[model samples]
Target: MSFAKEVKNELTQMQTEDCCTLACSYGLLLFSRAFSVSEISLLTEHSGVASLYCDAVALLSGYVADLQETPGGYSQVSVRDRQQRINIFEKLGLPVQSPRKQINLANLQNECCFGAFLRGAFLACGTVTDPTKDYHLEFSIPSAGLCEQFIKLFDEFDLSPRTTRRNGVSVVYFKNSTDIEDILAHMGASDTYMEFIGAKVIKDIRNQVNRKCNFENANAKRAVASAGAQRDAILYIQEKRGLDSLPKQLRELAQVRLDNPELSTAALLPLLSESLTKSGLHHRMKKIEQFAEELKNRSENEN
Candidate 1:
């Protein structure tokens, strides 16, 4: 099941305030596919949302809507009775004549009601991505004006959502995992919210481990390249002036590096007969490299 469906299922099991539930039902019907005085209709693929809508309407208007299941996995719920539709509008505080299809927050009694309203809106047209893959929650609004209004509602709760238009529909979305979690929790899907948090923790740990591994690999590559260059310099000096011509300490360090070309300066420390700190060994290797470079430059100038 989709994360969105999971959330709706959880919502279906929760107990909500009667007035708030009615307001939520109002939101779903008003913003859904069709809402008019003569006919109130909603189409959904989620059987849970369809049932919730039918029940919420029945609770509010005292009339059960007709649920028609089509061949394409859609459940269409409609109240074709004109009086029932008018009563639903009156119960929802919607004008009986040409009411604007916008969310009226005043109908909601409290924070719980507001949350329920958002839940109903989500049931109508919201979707959330699997937290294991990505953080995304969006609502497809039918118009830009309604989209902005919805954004204000989110802002009231500090959801920090963004909006865009796609194919003539306005989309309100949030990418932040924290925002998504807070939204789910606000809508009373605590279990799904906890699951999202767990997924986020796992993803964060994996990312941290990968970063550490990449950093260590980079350091290893740099060390290998440096060790290779040092060995090459030692070979150049030995070929040109011979190791015996160098200072005794430099000669011994050069021989040790030549024998163990793969070892780092720190590793070569224990191999030396005269003990030296890692930095002391590095200093000695630097002098040998400088001498080799001078020899090569002079040979080039002479040629």
Candidate 2:
């Protein structure tokens, strides 16, 4: 199943008290596809969410909503009876004819009820992308007023959310991984939240390992190139004036390069006749290259 479905399934299994049940049901109905005095419907791809919606309706209004599967393979639950929709609104203490659907903060009895309400809203209209792909969680609400209320509710929990409109639906979304994880945790999906955290840790470690490997590979390439250039300078000096023409220390370093052309400057340091730091060895190599360049220039001028 998808990660979002997994989260909803986990939420559906949570145990709720009388107050939390009412609060959660309010969220589910308010954010559903349609929730008014005339009609109350919830359309979802998750069967667990559909079942939860039906259970919430039965518990809150003493009415059983019609649940059916559409041709497109979606579970749709609807209460078409006008009396039943009014009954639901009465049980939830919602206005029968509000200008637009909005959250009833009076239903959220306590802090725990807030969490439960958010859980139900998620089950109704929320989705989360797989942590392996990206960190994104959103709720698609049909009413702009309801969407704005959700944004304020998120702020109450110290979670920052952004808003946008897509296809006439108001969407409240969070892209930060921490925010998504917190939302799952608050929704009582502790197991799914732990799984998401594990995925994030693994991804972070993999990225760090890749960056370290790239750094080492680049360093190795630079070492090889530097060694190749030093070897070319030594070869030129040998072919022109010969090793005997160089001073004692320079001649010894030149011979070492001719013997171990593939070794880096640091690796060649130990093979030197006299003790020298890496910096001193580098200085000597630069001097040898300079000498060869001067000799080449003089030869060219003479010709």
Candidate 3:
């Protein structure tokens, strides 16, 4: 389907028992824009529907803009566009317009405006048919504290967004579809809108890791299974090496690596004491890993 239609269909169904006026408005604008309708005849067939159809021609245009700018900083939404979306929210009267009512905050972030995340960040010119659900949204924030700001925002609004740390970044996943819909409603979104907010969340994360490791750099991926190994490594070290007795250097080094699984061994080099060399450092790391693996195997045997 065309990008506009896809957006329309998604928005039409954004409503649920918990949905309110604001979400409905945002959904309508998004739908009308996507379908290329000038005025929202569905709500009130104004003459703008006839003349404004021209504006609808570019409903998916902004989403295209979001795709081109990511991995680097993205272009901010235009003042006029922002105001228009706000108008939609005001008309609907979404619940989240707390500090300021009649103001929709959709499109505030690419990854998380109405709903959608991750893949939305990579959308090109056309409409992305995938229709991102929160279940698929994941993030690896470079800073845990900064990521918490978003987490709190969603939580406060009674929406659930999750975060898990990987490498040096905290990976957050917005896994609830209900929360996604609630956010869309909270933003005074129309049932017919297209959200690249998903893109912002995804890009916010990828841009962090991508700047350091892009699809070109062999795609730096870590398996979830490896996390247990690392955890076990820490536990084993503490148990066998007597985490307390292990020299301060060994304990500190292990903690840094385990805590920030994404950071390479090289990154940990500097965090070590001035007296430590890379080889000496590597040697200690190897012992921990080997011991952890051995413990894993033994545990499986006993089980």
Model 3, runs deviating above 4 Å: 1-219, 222-232, 239-242, 245-249, 297-303
Of candidate 3, the 10-residue stretch with the lowest lDDT total is 117-126
| Per-residue alpha-carbon lDDT of candidate 2 for residues 1-303, written as tens digits (9 for 90 to 100) | 889878888898888888898888888888888887767899999888899899988977787989999999999999968887778777777789962466778889988899989988888889999999999999988788787778888877899898889999989999999999889888889999999999999999999999999999999999999888888888898898898989999999989988997888889989987999999999999999999889989999999
lDDT by residue (1-303, candidate 3, tens digit) is: 443344434433343322222232233333321211122222212222222222322342322111122333432222135444444344344332331222234533332343432112111111222334223434444334435554554554666766676666656565554554454444434442235456446756876887766654543344334444665678776775566755665678778776777665655777765657778876877777776667668878999
lDDT of 1 at 75: 97
User: What TM-score does prediction 1 earn?
Assistant: 0.90
TM-scores for all candidates?
Answer: 0.90, 0.93, 0.24
Candidate 3, 63: how far from true, in Å?
A: 58
Residue pairs with clashing backbones, model 1: none
Estimate the overall C-alpha local distance difference test score of candidate 1: 0.84
What are the per-residue Cα lDDT tens digits for candidate 1 across 1-303? Answer: 887778888977778777777767767876677677766788999888899889867976898999999999899999878898888878777788654446676788776887887888888888899999999999988556567677888866877788888898888988998899888988888889888899999999999999999999999998899899999998898898899989999999999999998887789988989989878988998999899999999999999
Error of 3 at 122 (Å): 40
Highest TM-score: give the candidate number. 2
Which one is best on lDDT? 2
Candidate 3 total steric clashes: 40
